[model samples]
Structure formats: structure tokens, C-alpha cells
Target: MSTPGKVSLEDKFGLFTDHWSPKIVGELNGQQVKLAKISGEFVWHAHEHEDELFLVTRGTLLMRFRDGEQRIGVGEFIIVPRGVEHQPVAETGEVWMLLFEPSSTVNTGTAGGERTVTELERL
Candidate 1:
């Protein structure tokens, strides 16, 4: 068994530089805590049974929805409710964020395609 310790978001964010790929850092109650670096635009999609929480750590995130979009800045977060179509964009530059969702939640949601990450990497 392993003992609990502290996780440094800055250090974990440094482990990888790839965009759109989320690395698992922790898990609790069937939920996963992930870290990801994002830039450019991501495919529009929706989770059928799970809500997603995106917490901006550095830079900003523009979340686009069918009707409008919400801008998320560092230390702030936004929750995309289940079944609500939305897209994540980092128009300014690279953005760092923490993701909170169900362990079974897929990054690409129901729009599965090339961007779908079937196997997740653990930090």
C-alpha cells in the first residue's frame, strides 16, 4: 500500500507538454483528477452521463456552448453539465487546467474520433 502525500500542480504540469492529453494525478470516489495543457480548439462534444469540471491553473480557457461561451481564468473553474454540448478553446495561448470527472468519463465524449484517448497516462 502507498501512503498519501501532497501533489504539486506546477510540478505535475511540467511532466508533460502535449496539448489535449490529460494525465491522471489522483482519484477519489470513482472520480479522477487530471491535469492537461490545452491550446487551439477542441472538438465540440457532450457527456451523456457525467458532468465535467475544468479548473484553470494558468492562462485562460474559453468554453463554447451552443448559445454562447464562458471565459475561465486562472484560479477559476467552470462545470459543464452532462449532455450539454460544449467545446474548449485556448485562443490566447497554452492554458493549464485541472479536470474533475467520473473515472469512466471520456475526454472526447460522444464524438469519438482521432482525438479520443482510450488509454490514459498516470502522473
Candidate 2:
């Protein structure tokens, strides 16, 4: 009722059909929490301004950064700090990514690689 005051997952899912980009589902203070479906390989990027929190809601996620690579299974999470360049790679499976960042966070804050999340893809 009253427009539900929030959009459902199915409605949000109809908002995008791509990769890398995360769709805003809700917010906490000045921080934004979004859900994104991803596959294949993403670009090497960094926030450079703030830390980023990623949760694997489904499937597995492989995050590779300047240091090394870490495999995150479903129900797992990883935190990447500022200025740390990282790339995300999914192994031929669907993944639900919940990202927490500032309200003005960029998909590729300081990146020069391919597969950037310029817009919501596969929301």
C-alpha cells in the first residue's frame, strides 16, 4: 500500500540488463546499498576516496587486486580500501553483489581498465 514505499526485487530486476553496474535499492544515511548481478571479468578499478564493502549474495566472486586474488563464496564478503586497485571476476555463474559505499561513489572511481560500471547492468 501507499506505493509500498520501496521497489521489489522483480521491479528492480527490470531496471537493468548488463554487467558491472550496481542498481540502487536502498540507502543508509549518506551511504548507498545496491544489488548487482555480474558475470565474466570486470575492470581494474579503485575508489581512491573511501573503502568499499562487497557481499556475495549468490554464487562465487573472485576479487583480484594489486596484492593478490581472493575467492569469495556465497554468504562471504570482502572489503577493499581506498587507492587499492581491484578487479572482479565471476566464474561462469550468476552472482548477487551487495555494495556499500558513499552516496557519490563511482563504479570506477579511478580506473583505466575495461568493463566499467557506467550504468546499471542486469539489475
Candidate 3:
């Protein structure tokens, strides 16, 4: 068995420098909380049956949809419903974000390819 302790977002975010790849931080009730650093544009994809929540921790995140786009800034978050085609972009340098989704959620969603992360690293 393992002992449960408090988690610090700042300390966790400092663990990696990779872009787009998310690192798992915590889990609850079949859901997972992840941290990721992103820059530039990401693949346009949609979760067939999972809703994804993105909470900006640092910098700004641009969420592009078929109709329009939304800017998610620090302390702000956006929830993309299941099956909504969307893309995340960080044109203004690196951005830190927290993602809340189901444990089975894939980074690339339905558009599986090279960017798909089948396994995630736990922090």
C-alpha cells in the first residue's frame, strides 16, 4: 500500500518540459487529473464519448472550434463536450494546463496517429 499526500501544482509542473504530452497527477472516481505544457498548434480531434476539461495554469490557451475559438487564460478553464471537434493552440509561448477527463481518455481522441499517447506517466 502507498500513503496519500498533498500535491503541489507548481512542483508537478516543473517535472517536465515536453509539449502536448500530459503527465498524470491524480485520479478519482474513474477520472484522471493531468498536467501538460503546450505550445503552438495541436491536432484537431474530438473525444467520441469523453468530455475534456482544460484549466489554464500559466499563459493563455486558444481553443479553436469549427465555428469559432475561445481564449482560455490563467485561472480560466473550458470544458469541451464529447464529440466536439476542437484544437488547442498556444501561440504566445509555453502554456501550462491541467486536464480533467476519464481514465480512458486519449490525447488524440478519435484521430489516432503518431501523437496518440497510449500510456501516460504518473507524477
Candidate 4:
């Protein structure tokens, strides 16, 4: 069992400096809340069985789809439904965001590569 307490997002974020690597901050109801500081572009991928929720904490995030793109900013969020092909990009600068998804969800989805994180580190 894990200890129960309040988690400061900012404080947790301060513990890491790498980009694209998500650190688990908390879990609830079989889902995980993760944090990542990202920049540049990610691979085009899709979660066949899991939907992903991205909530921006700082900077900007542009979610690209085959149809179009959505620019998310601070305090903004977007959900990419299952089976939808999408990619996340930070063209402006570094972006900090919280990800809410199932514990089984992988960072790279079906497009596994060097950027794929199979095991997540807990903060």
C-alpha cells in the first residue's frame, strides 16, 4: 500500500529535468496521474484501447491530428479518444502537463521507439 497525502504538482515537477519522460505522481481508481516536461514533436501514435487526457500546467502544447490541430495552453486540456491517431508538439517552448490515463497506458502508444517508456518512475 502507498501513503496517502497531498501532492504538490510544482514540487514534483521540480524533481526532474528530462523531457518526454513522465513521472507518476499519484494513482486513483486504476488510473495514473503523470507529469512531463516536453518540447519538440512526438511521434504520431494512437492508443487503441485507452483514451488520454492532457492538462497543460505551463507553456503551450499543440495536439495534432490527421484532421487538424488544437493548440492547448496553460490551464487548458484536451482528450484524445481511443483509436484516434495524434501527435503532441511544443513549437513555442517547453511545456509542462499532467496526464491522466489508465495504469496500463504506455507513453508511446502503438508507435513504440526510442522515446517509448515501458516502465514509469514514481515521484
Best by TM-score: 1
Q: What is the C-alpha lDDT of each candidate?
A: 0.97, 0.79, 0.96, 0.96
Local accuracy of candidate 3 as per-residue lDDT tens digits, 1-123: 899899999999999999989999999999999999998999999999999999999999999999999999999999999999999999889999999999999999988889898889999
Local error of candidate 4 at 56, Å? 0.2
Using lDDT as the measure, name the better of candidate 1 and candidate 2. Answer: 1
TM-scores of all candidate predictions against the true structure: 0.97, 0.79, 0.96, 0.96
Task: Give the TM-score (vs. native) of candidate 4.
Answer: 0.96
TM-score between model 3 and native: 0.96
Candidate 4 per-residue C-alpha lDDT over 1-123 given as tens digits, one digit per residue, 9 for 90 to 100: 999889999999999999999999999999999999999999999999999999999999999999999999999999999999999999988999999999999999999999999889999
Candidate 1 clash figure, as a count = 0
Q: Provide the lDDT at 37 for model 2.
A: 81
Candidate 1 clash pair list? none
Q: Residue-wise lDDT of candidate 2 within 1-123, one digit each (tens)?
A: 365476566567567766676888877789987888898887788886888889887789999987789999878999998888898889877777788888777887777445555554333
Whole-model alpha-carbon lDDT for candidate 3: 0.96
Error of 4 at 28 (Å): 0.8
Stronger candidate by TM-score (2 vs 3): 3
Error of 3 at 34 (Å): 0.2
Span of 10 residues, lowest total lDDT, candidate 2: 114-123
Q: Summing lDDT over every window of 10 consecutive residues in candidate 1, give the lowest-scoring window.
A: 111-120
